[model samples]
Target: MPHTLRLTVTALVGLVVLAVVGAQAVSVEPAATPSTVVRTSETTRLPAPDAPNVVVFLTDDMRKDDLGYLPHVRNLLMKRGMTFTEAQSPHPLCCPARAALLSGQYAQNNGVHHNSGAYGGWESFDPSSTIATWAEDAGYATAIHGKHLNHFDADAPADPGWTNFDILLEPATDFENFTFFDGDSFNDDYVTTRLDERTVADIDTWAGRRPFMIFANHVAPHIWFPESAKGDGDGDRGGRLPPAEAAYAHALKGITPRAFKDPAFNEADMRDKESIVSGRPKLAPRPLKRLNLARIRSLLSVDEAVAHTVAALERAGELEETYIVLTSDNGYALGEHRFTGKDRLSDEILDVPLVIRGPGIPAGTRSARTVSLIDLTATLAQLMSLTPTMTIDGEHFVPTLRDPEAVGLRDTMLIQTGAKDPSARFPGWAYRGVLTQRYSYARRINNGPTAGFLYDRRQDPHELANLLSDERYRAVRRELERRYRVLADCSGTACNRDFGPLPRPRPAR
Candidate 1:
């Protein structure tokens, strides 16, 4: 049998055992109150008669600044919502980031460090301790649609907390038609359109009856039907763009930051960095521009889907009672330092956009606070007035939403890549670091020699220069290393304290 199939069988066996034991021990549990609450200026907000509804739209591999291309998102969400300027994906990989968001734990604690390995992806994740489970136990209807994790298959056992589950089995090549299992049956259709329709229908069905949460995951804007994978005689390989979105080709120009194709693209700086960075293709300007445009065109449907969802909520009379959050699982690297995909400890891949509009959140405000995907779990738990039963590596960022000027809950944010094992999908991608407002630092772990990276964000926002070897920044690098060590293994409240407040946002040039 193939390796993936063998693993799936093993995992199913484990899940059956777990389900049997869990069913026996499970009992009705009372909802718990929020563990911590931060004061805000808006104390007069009305309490909800029931739990507030939550709608999360998570896009895959979307660049932070790409939100400009989606007008509906900008006007409806950003103009009427609060934007977190420094939000990041702590672990910029598909499986690991999703796992962290669901479990509120870092890859080290969650045991899903890489996209595929002995301890990676869905099989290793403990589904019983996810945000969906927490919300379901709190008496809120929960559903998840779209991408779940890399390598998920038919044999994968259903997650216990979700009342409705529709997920893509694996990455698809044909963007126009992809297979999805909608709880009861497997069907092939245009994924983006299907997901949008199902989401609105779900809202129509559950509105005014109960508090519900729906996670609409989009796969667009991710690389689809790459040239390398095309015409291999596989039925999956075909055109990536749907016919409706073809008109958007080259709609917007691609952005080339100062670091794009820099002299240091693949130059040997440190021994450890060379193993992963060297020999990679330098991004060609023309091709990179075209690729970036393709990404934007792919998101047009997602933008339309957002508009439809909000309209559906309004029609259902649930718009005022629902919290809408727009974000991405991870950011993509486009010709930044000779890279075009994620899985590196760089700003290009780590920085993601986060916008939220809800009952108590301020409107038309921008926050410079630094936050991460892991915090989503804690934020949802608090929004529904439920305490988590498991220890998590995230803090409630609801205060930031309530008051954009409020001090950030976390002082330092942890950014990481997956394991470096030879069996791992992306070997030598292992690294962990701490990101502050003004600096980004990383050190290779479990592979290669003691390699370290340090960038002064204020001086080089694009990270064109490496200051790790500069004698002037020696003391700064040492201090960052100390903080990274302290946070690398932290969990729960230990990871919630403020290291230091971020500097004010920089003035536009």
Candidate 2:
């Protein structure tokens, strides 16, 4: 089916489903009159006094530096918005990440841990616990356009969420709504442009009705290398521009990050390849056999779409009133550590960009404090003065937007993977790690549990050293092990697993 027509029909189906579901689905009671509730003089600041609109602009499988703003995204956001330098996804996949972001809980709690088709499976979404519900109840016009992981069940249709906008644009790829197949660039039209149009129109049309929240998820820059004949350039689909844009390629060629300039560079450039081929491309060469140009080129459309969305928000007089959060579902690995993409536990694939701009946010502020995407839900709930439905694993980071240097409530960021279902890549590679200011340590869990992929992030940010066996770092290993155990005990992930707590007691000053 043609991408345009398919998305249009899909959008209509979404609307009809939402109308039927929104009326029948249970609704949560709102707080009593505003005057009855006490106002805080100090820290309990709402997200800008004027009920500003909310726009969450999410990308597919984007790396932290894929944006034109590059590493200075924090400062860039600060100038126009706020930035969370340490933002992370609960699990480095699509559906799970989206679910956790929307529900404000970890994969174990939400039950959408892996990609929808994995053995453990997807489709079991908690209807009542979604940000859309809160926003709708708060009298905001909610619209979810791009990807709707919360919209379907077992590849079949389901009410996306109780939002005002019934339009859901599901792609033809497996109906999972999260997976972006490589070499299938032609299929990525709705997310790149169509949704942008829809968002702009929605913002313009509903400018005065009430505050609004639009979730525009774009599927760009995701994996799947096109055939080598296409040449490494952004391929041009039959739209405004063709894929494999040379200008974008040249720009990315200059992106050569300082961190990736080592003598021991891998032959396969970790940077995304832009396919410059005309017409539709084939997908047979596979990873090593195909050219990297297509991947880089693919990202151009996504970047343009982002800029367009930002422009739209600004033109509609909604930018300032809208908390525009630009981020990714998960980070992508161009070619780091011999890995092509995510579904692995690595810093390159796990660390994603988080840019926030809107009312009350300090322009150009950047915080290195560890943060996670799950924090976004809590932050949104707190910002809008809504009660989070359940125990949220993430902390409210709205305070960090204002005071970048402000100390956060949580000391560590926990990543759980490789344990639950054996079907996923790197299965049985259960691991946990912490990114401290000075270093990072990760432990591997196997039949006989032990430390895995331990690294001295300060010296080896590339994650080459497996410092698990070195006697000199025994103390470091023990400390990391203890910390991981403590986090696991408190996290309530999957199960206790009886890994036991740290044997060492806290050091006395």
Candidate 3:
């Protein structure tokens, strides 16, 4: 690992609580920063509600490995909840990932592919039988705040079930001006601040009255640093630079894009990645610094947003009874593999941050079990006993949560990108792959440069090396191709495949 990236992982490990019962152990870096520990004070116990209220903080375009930027979330969610280290957004993109979260099905199964245009976007999703409606039917008050799918209109009728729907219509290009369909306009209220306030207000109204589920969707640390941004990142309108509040404009100033220079960053060779990312020019320093720094600065308020949500739940005396989930729709890339955006099936983009606390979950624990956004929604449905109105392609995590040491039911995770659309960031060819605990293999259509590729993820964490063309990998490639075919077009029960223990580990190259 690069020294700086090592520092980040070390710093995060210092903050993570050591655990019991098969918890993953960490060898702390001697120079790791001392943990900035925080503990939320407990409130006086109140009468238990009929069921646990669920609050999900669904952040946008946040990298799975970037949890260190969220101190409050690290201290509160990680320290108090169970962290899923291998959580993934199998189809890593805004519209597809969000659809998976709502429908408990893969992008192919859900019928939502690209971010916008004919085959994708809001028109493709069937929200009529989503978790919102399912939960609402089960007598829970449901609400969602911030960005919905791409191409959804601010004037669009509220999707079926939610009691409160506050959706951001356009890209968060103007944090101070984007309007929520629910009559919210930001004259001066920043995006994160306003979302936090509205969430707190909802907790205040529904905490003691009924079981509730609030999706506090935040556009923090995403792209389009508002034209109104007036601080260090003001000049960054590159679409990759996130908009931070003025107070946080200088935060994380020291951790520039150079800090994340893993071997994959602007890699020297493109022969192996020729299939999709073959000919991109090397990324420049100025843009990398802007993208990295602004991304970090933009998340400071989101950390505060987490703090606010916890405080509100505590004040309502519902903290102990509510299930709090902190996660992201998908992840973004910052110059890794000479790429600057998402929509690729790289580990950097497919992995998503996932942590949960409340009720029966043990504090400071970890689950090594790999799961996807598709699986997460199914798990939520199972937790609430909501009978899905449609077919669910993923399995629930209740068993894994109930027993962290046991192996999970699903063994393979499908990672695919939709065909390029005129409205999206990635104009690459459609690709599909299957990720196991150790290996990553993918194939592309449209006769892209390198038709297929594979990586031994356990050995090549940065994925700088591809093994598909290797003579020794012939057997493994055949097996992976079979699995990929099974999952790429799979639906419902057929989608959850257990391929036994991982294919026998290959010797170190």
Candidate 4:
């Protein structure tokens, strides 16, 4: 399977099976609509009087390729919206990516690099100025449900810019039994379904009054283990995969995942790769299928959630006027390069799913433009006609969305492998490099192996061969490194500039 493709027919039988079981499965109704109705505003002030409402579905640890599990999302959104096949997460970790999403700046500027500590977690984020505040101030009622940031609980209230917020507390990674700020806890109800229902309740109230932007975050399909001691990114905590809705647990019992055919699957060699590939053993076959089965199964509910949310907008007469964006905080690495988590600097982590459908957004077209969570945030704020108090490192790509002929705002930008310590997620690993439309490059910055590799995606899509040390490609590396230095500490306009066409990788000698 290629990086940006949907699952093939043979390997995708499980998706159909899961869909069947999911429809028939008995589930909880959208939790009793919140006691209070959603936010209501007298006016929707904007550059355009009839600007569309924005609804963002941010799934946790979902890969760009996993879009196959979504049937309704495919029919309603993908077929009706623009999909950015080349979109990526600037910092492919939980906190950093979300921080960037909220502030429109990279981790270096936002200060939330890892998952915890001074450099990580909810406390590290500055909630005063963000898309939420920009939208709220601009007259859109804003709300966020489900996961806000890791280590967030009822105790820490930063007012993080939402007019209404209901987020799960620290240790928020689980299928059930976790509590939210409102004290309404989940014991038997599936979190994915619950989040949707709760958010639908908000949509029911908020829509039709004034435009609203809701961030519906979910924690399904993330590797779940409550009893076992689980340290982040340290080999899947012994191969434990999250379970699907109980009724549909065995829906995908027997089927292969297209991801396994991905050339990077159980990479055969690592000598030419990032040092983090300290050479772990290949993932066993049975477990790989088992893990993907769980992912596919878990997503059934998310697909249903997408449908329910879209339907809710339609019922409220807000469907056509709303910009429904679906994406993930970061991508999951399913047995790629023999690694099973997102901490590494692999494309499996760097690349994420970004789909949008709304007013003026061209229908059923895939944007070749290079976009990121950071860029999208800025664009959304720009669409709302808000001039930010904070500097936005990302560029607005409205041109690409409205016209496919337009190039992306960013053709090159800095990419980093987050901290190794506080979480030890990727122990003894830290790096930064530049990513262009066709090239992937990074160099380690921590102790031990201090070198990195370069990949010309046009030729080596799997990133199997390292072009860093190859004498013929010296010009490519030179240009990449030069851009990395400028972007490593770049801010605002300077950071979002396209480095222009990549100097072509030399032909085989």
Give TM per candidate.
0.80, 0.69, 0.85, 0.88
Output the number of the TM-score-best candidate: 4
Native-referenced Cα lDDT, model 2: 0.54
Model 4, position 487, has a per-residue lDDT of: 88
lDDT of 2 by residue, 284-388 (tens): 324322223344445544544445555556556666677878888888665455445565566766888888887778777777767778888788877776665
Error of 4 at 192 (Å): 1.2
Overall lDDT per candidate, in order of appearance: 0.69, 0.54, 0.73, 0.75
Task: Write down the TM-score for model 2.
Answer: 0.69
lDDT of 1 by residue, 1-509 (tens): 23453344334433432342221111111112211111111122233466899999999888888776666676568877899888889898878888998889988788887776665667778877788777776766777777786546776666767777767665443455456654332234345767777777778777987788888888777666532345322112243532234434433443443334555443333332335564565556775666666776677667767767776787778888889999998887766666767878888789888989888887889998788898877887789886577999887788888888877566777888876366644443478888887899887775443465778888878776666666677677777877888887888888766766433333435
Q: Give per-model CA RMSD.
A: 14.4, 14.1, 9.2, 5.6
The true-versus-predicted C-alpha distance at residue 292 of model 3, in Å, is 1.3
- The clash numbers for all candidates, in the given order, read 0, 38, 0, 0
**Candidate 4: global Cα-lDDT?**
0.75
Better of 1 and 4 by TM-score: 4
Better of 1 and 2 by TM-score: 1
